[model samples]
Target: MKGGKIGESGGLTFWLASPGDYDDVMAISDGIYEGNDYLPHRYHSWMTEPYRVVILAKRDGKLVGLASGLIVDGGSTVFLEGMRVCSREQGRGFAGVIQRFTDQYIRQLYPNVRMKRLVRGEDPRPEKLAKFSLLAKRAILSLQIEAKAFHAFLSTLRAKLEHETGTGSLEQESRLVVLEEEQLRHILLDPGVSSQIELPGHMIIQDWQPLKLVESNFEVLRRRNLTWLADSLEQPTFLSLHTPPYPIPYKGGSFRFSIDLFGTKADLACRALLAHMEMVRGAPQLFQDPQTGGTCC
Candidate 1:
């Protein structure tokens, strides 16, 4: 793949990644992730995958960042697999440059695919939720219950149905209600019913619009820089970027939940969290601001 230069500084260059770039990419990933479980370990496989696109960014002949995207759902959806920037090189607007270029490259390569990613968070801070709403426009609560808990709830519902209809077990009852995934999603999203489930885990699931290349947004990001972005947030409180060994608030017990922001600002927090999600799975368009209930450009 051909390489191109980015930024007016004349130091940054970007190119499609190959297996040969694995070592350099991993070095950057290692520095940024620092043994974090969220680091991607399948760079070689991604380099060879027909539906995957990996982009590497270099500055002064040194690897500075790497990003990858994949075509999923049989070519109907494009997922950003991961992205990483060198520890020392971060906060310099390289992320926005790399992301914007990669997004455009992916769309050109797969014009027919829609872009989407899953954003999962448990009891997210109000600021984070607001930022997500600005980007995704839609969010749902996900309730994950233990199998035993779910079975108990199902059994009780089944018993009630059987009593009312004078039917046998659900397997033999023609009128039995079999809850589909959509029904569960609906129930979890419904505020009235959501609190009643009392599931072990609660998370907000954001369904973002397909990714698109917006030169204007990237240009704004580049000019203003991450520091400016950080200072722009309405609420500047700090939070931890690490996930816990287990989801918190177990059994409604008071558990100490803390995020050590280390003085990072809200915009950086938003970017870091979203970028972390991309490494594990992982938008653009005017979205409705959840806080203001107004459209965000």
Candidate 2:
């Protein structure tokens, strides 16, 4: 997306995001998502990504609001994310103004974009969002474990999985298969293989980022450091993707671990989940976080 002056309205001026606006944007985004906002981690790259737009709102030369959209699915769909407004500037309709600005900008610049998509945490009323159609709803589980106690936690978890599944170490190892980024790209691109893979709404959503099985979309997915897993390469019955834990603002030095599991095999799903956690546990010091002066995996 290009960074330039957008339309001004009622003392508010909109513009595309630039690298220098990082601090101002983060200033107003405090406490967002209860300290789990992903904007800080993705802002810089979002500015440089192709076919992606990040719009900002300013009043009297001060940044106050922000929104972003990514054009994907061969320019037929735009995924909206990272919409925010300053703490003191909320409840004044700046957020909606930013979105509407983005809407017109897409129309003028990216006429190829047709569908607009987003993920909301709360259930919305049908009358309020009549223009949008619901694709699917998901239930999420969150766990909190201190870094010092994570190993013990994993040990206990492994024991429970073993006891419930009646599987020893060797047998469990033989039951799981891990795929590389390129391999996953190849697998998803194969029409026959992807047609056979199970998905709700037939969509591949990695942590709320809806993805299409197109070559360009696959390149966008490759930007993240992820672990791909499946039951078998020849004919996979289950699939999973894991992103390494990264520091969050919850406790000042804590990390958030995320997992996206696919397929419906009850026992196989359990094995895949454990396998992903163990993969992270095996390398506790993978990524370096400058703020904490420590490593997170």
Candidate 3:
């Protein structure tokens, strides 16, 4: 908790967050995101991540604000996430103070990180949009389910879909395929796939992260634990990236899943979504909190 010249501009002392700050940071974060917050699961791990810093604000030794920034895209862009302020400090503008502190820290640490990027659940106003280039936008949907009945629910959904479509044993396997992690770079960066698949805004947005399809970014992409699927490895009609489910603080406890599909064909995208769903239904590691039946949406 090194502090002295912290938040001089806003009269709040700011410093880099450490594992010791977990309880304090989380105490103020209670009920954030309507109890579906992701920070609880990511805080500890975020401290170990390179090119990232979790900034905290304190007044008279009390934790009041928190924000984080990470240098991604080969140190060319800084992505901000998990920004929060204690309820007592909300109306006092401490949120903006911590944000500026994080920004200044990242700037000094990574002078090459010229671009600032962030993902917002709500749409921004015209003035806010004018400062940042409009990268890409996606519609998000939510669902809820029980942890004990997780696999069963997935199985039921798959069975119902197959029964309705009459694809009991064939339609999907013959149409969709998953590529090995080793094949990701070759498959995704291939001229053929790039030419065939629609790269929205010519950028790769996964988990709300915008990355350019370049060689430098491949290493970063590989770390995301993404599962890649396409119609064909040689010449793909559609592609999808699935991020396995992870825990969140929603309705007590829960897991979060994401599917990013690239293609203009509505029918093919639907098929790919179903295929991805079937692929993860049997993965036991994703949701193991049996006592807590959670939301899948």
Candidate 4:
């Protein structure tokens, strides 16, 4: 679509994103997701992928918002990965303006595609779901494990793995390894193996389903660094380690983990378990007990 003025302000313009828009797009995303590092890398990948569409809104030459969507499920589904307006531009009707514009753009490009977005309970603006014609189909119960419980669970699981393999402890390992999809599946979904260990968190299993794969020019499984993994063909996926209460309050704080698991439940229990281990192994101090003021093992 041709770029043009968006509103009476005349300062806002909407257009399809190009390679040059990466920095501006990321700047807007950083503000919206609270300085997430994962999106920037995936945004670069998306710019080259044929199955993705990125729309950007700029106000008087500065980027103010963006909407990224992927054509998935064999071109029958349009998955809206993210949509956000900069903090300064929010509440001034920019959201609805961008949302309406993006919807029209997608309909023209993929008229038969069913649009969807995985909405989290903690999503800042739940009202935005209506813009994409997305409705609540199901609720996945996400568990928030306490620091102590998570530590204990990782300790037990690590001991079990070491005992079975006759290998040294994984605790000393400070690197993150990108597991092959099959290797991850075996490690996480094998009922006989994981059931042996007493997992600490409250047990809640979301229903599992095979994710629809869409080809991307980027190698989603490849790791750009030791600390993160991306494993999706249709959607931009990321598994990264970061500390909680972000913008890291102090130099040696406890570590936390975050991942983008857009809707498809593929061994979340295993992912969460491993994520805790990742934080412990990679950045132990971040997991320190806030009250007792003790560092993680």
Best by lDDT: 2
Ranking by lDDT: 2, 3, 4, 1
- Model 1, 241-262: lDDT tens per residue? 2222211223321111112122
Question: Per-candidate RMSD vs. true structure?
Answer: 18.3, 2.6, 2.7, 10.2
Which one wins by lDDT: 2 or 3? 2
Model 1 has an lDDT value of 0.44
> What does the lDDT read for residue 30 in candidate 3?
89
- Least accurate 10 contiguous residues by lDDT in model 1: 280-289
lDDT of 2 by residue, 10-118 (tens): 5689888899888998898889987777787778888898888899889988999898889988888899999998989899988777888888888788898888988
Decoy 3 TM-score against native: 0.88
lDDT of 4 by residue, 146-233 (tens): 4557667667776765575454754343333455554443433344322333221211111211123222211222222223332332
> Residue 42 in model 3: shift from native, Å?
1.6
TM-score of 1: 0.40
Model 4 residue 103 CA deviation (Å) reads 1.4
RMSD of 3: 2.7
Ranking by TM-score, best first?
2, 3, 4, 1
Residue 161: error of model 3 in Å? 4.2
- Index of the highest-TM-score prediction: 2
- List ranges where model 3 is wrong by over 4 Å: 1-7, 148-156, 159-174, 191-195, 285-287
Predicted candidate 3 versus true structure: per-residue lDDT over 1-297, tens digit per residue: 322444445777777788888889889988998867878877887888767777888888788788888778888989898888889878887777777778888898899988999889999999989888887787776666676666677667667666766868447545777888767788767766665787766767887777777766777678768888877777776788887777777777777777888878765676677777667665675555564557464
Q: Residue 252 error for model 2, in Å?
A: 1.4
Q: Would you list the clashing residue pairs of candidate 2?
A: none
Root-mean-square deviation of Cα positions for candidate 4 versus the true structure, in angstroms: 10.2
